[model samples]
Target: MKEVTPTDSEEHVRRRVSEKCSVDESPRFSRQQSFGRDIGHAAAETYLVTRLSFNLLGYLGLGYQWITRLLALACYAMLLMPGFLQVAYLYFFSPQVKRSIVYGDQPRNRLDLYLPPTSDGLKPVVIFVTGGAWIIGYKAWGSLLGLQLAERDIIVACLDYRNFPQGTISDMVGDVSHGISFVCKNISAFGGDPNRIYLMGQSAGAHISSCALIEQAIKESRGESISWSVSQIKAYFGLSGGYNLFKLVEHFHNRGLYRSIFLSIMEGKGSLEKFSPGVRLKDPRVKKAASLLHHIVLFHGSADYSIPPEASKTFADALRAVEVKTDIIIYEGKSHTDLFLQDPLRGGKDELFDHIVSMIHAEDSDALTKDAVAPERKRLVPEFLLKLAGKVSPF
Candidate 1:
């Protein structure tokens, strides 16, 4: 029997074959990954389209009017897709973003927190409730605002709650209040200052949060045992919100929100005055409760058709009538989404962003000085796209 020894060339040939086999498999593996991603993306798009379609049908019914608005909305979204995608990526993957943190026991009772880079001091907190009419409301809607504020050393808690169909107006209010209580009690663990917590909401969120704030105040005035105190909130900021459901119901109906759907979200016409912050404050019994409310600042766009600037104006006047300090700022020619979306996407020194930051940092001279010299934010969407989006926006 003879033993054979392999030569170096033979061994080299064997290794080369192994390397070739590995190389051939690599592309297949990469292709599989790519295919999986494509499938996931397709599924997400289908889900979103289906959900949006169902919501539209439920809220506006089957009509040419809604179909036309949907087309416009689709065009608007596509035009702003570049900015939306970037923010979505950051929202889902950024280390600074802590998503789906539970604040209550109910389903959808979750919130997302945007943490600043440095935890040097207890930073001011903004508990933000996002808007989505009533059916599509979700906390992720505030990702852009949360990320921007977090960059300025602010802690942002974007609260998620049960939307219409899942729950009614009262449920949404309760969820927001519960979320606020959680943040007020636990935000310190995340480097948020308890005393300087500010409450903020946009559109429907503004209405919901306002209701929660008012309800809490009324409870406190009545000596009801509460999980959170109105005194704990430093201020309330309502952005393009409707406060008087009594006034807004018909307006919303004409604007495509529809009377039936609007009434249902509001728990019917009978409950409209009960949920209306402006109307509720006019009552003498709630005057003491209103007095306990912190400063309120309302921001609305003059050209906003979703909810008119007068909604904010009338609410501010109501707050003043009860001796509560209130202020309303209106941006001329700005649409419903312009101040919140387009301006932020166009990115430099945003007037609304600056106004909010300035107020939040009012007590901190050093922060104000830093902000004064802070570099302008990089633009996400092109000017042309933003203009097109504005024209096509259904909101």
Candidate 2:
């Protein structure tokens, strides 16, 4: 891990601001520049929506079950539009956000950073991978979480990678690994503590990140050279993610992700064992690799039929069997998006969010003190709308 002093951190920030200003300044053609940027953003949004619509239609034919579920999902989204729009605005225009930082040579190898206001001391960092099944994941999906964590003085790096058709499971894992390597090496320049970095992923992202972490540990156990070490990571947090693909194949198939489509996303049935973190941990050869891991934490909702809480429970059991320090927290009656999206948007006090913040601030008395007195976040959507959205949510 690289150590950075206060002076070094300040100087780095100054250089970065100077460079950004140089690139951003266009006073002579300000009007034209603004018009061009708006046009570009509009085009990008159109392309994204069109692509997602086509992909979703392709996978889920026009079956009655899918059509009904799609209708419900759309209703859920509509009910939460107020919150979504607010979050989208912050994600695209917030001064605290640094968007589209390239991490690799691939077209989609980019990430967005959410930074805290004060850079006095090194802040704990989280490299978050957002969930969008396996076909629609994007870094912007993490903006809400990033904004909340940044307010509590934590740095967040939300990563983007190639989704299905464009890239398979192997490609996604490789992209995440590369993103982690970049953060582990370069975060110090951004006033992030290299020693306190955490890895977190939601839904499909959870599975992809776990595969990358386990694969890295395996490589290290074999004395293979690597860019980043598992030891460098403080902990791994899996949020509503499926660990054993074999157990989830049928579950996902029934939920609109057909087996054939899911199989192809996982690169066929032969790769199931290779990608399943829970199953891979049972292998004798991986014991040494597993021992290298610091801690594993899994969070899930008891009512999440999308993947089921049993997935986290079983994975936790496997981690303990391997002698890895592990903990699983189940939110009773909470749905998949409730813990990740609705709860955060509903705003006041969130048990899951509190738990995460408590863990991150355990060793810092001052940080914990600040967190305890922090003002409650204002609700983005009305209580009635939130309730309606929850009832209509397909996930």
Q: Which candidate is the best by lDDT?
A: 2
Superposed model 2: Cα runs more than 4 Å off: 1-42, 52-56
> For candidate 2, which ten residues in a row score worst on lDDT?
1-10
- Candidate 1 residues lying further than 4 Å off, grouped into runs, are 1-60
Clashes by residue pair, model 2: none
1-395 per-residue lDDT for model 1 (tens digits): 01111122333423432331234456779557545644674476468547765765665668666578778988999999999999988876576887666677886787888999887989999999999888778788899999999999899999989877778999999999998988877777677899999999999999999999999999999999998999999999999999999888788777777788889888988999988999999999999999899899999999999999999999999999999999889999998999989999999989999989999999999899989898899999999999999988999
Best by TM-score: 2
Per-residue lDDT, model 1, residue 248, is 88
Worst 10 residues of 1 by lDDT: 1-10
Taken over the whole model, the C-alpha lDDT of each candidate is 0.86, 0.88
How much does candidate 2 score in TM-score?
Answer: 0.92
lDDT of 2 at 231: 93
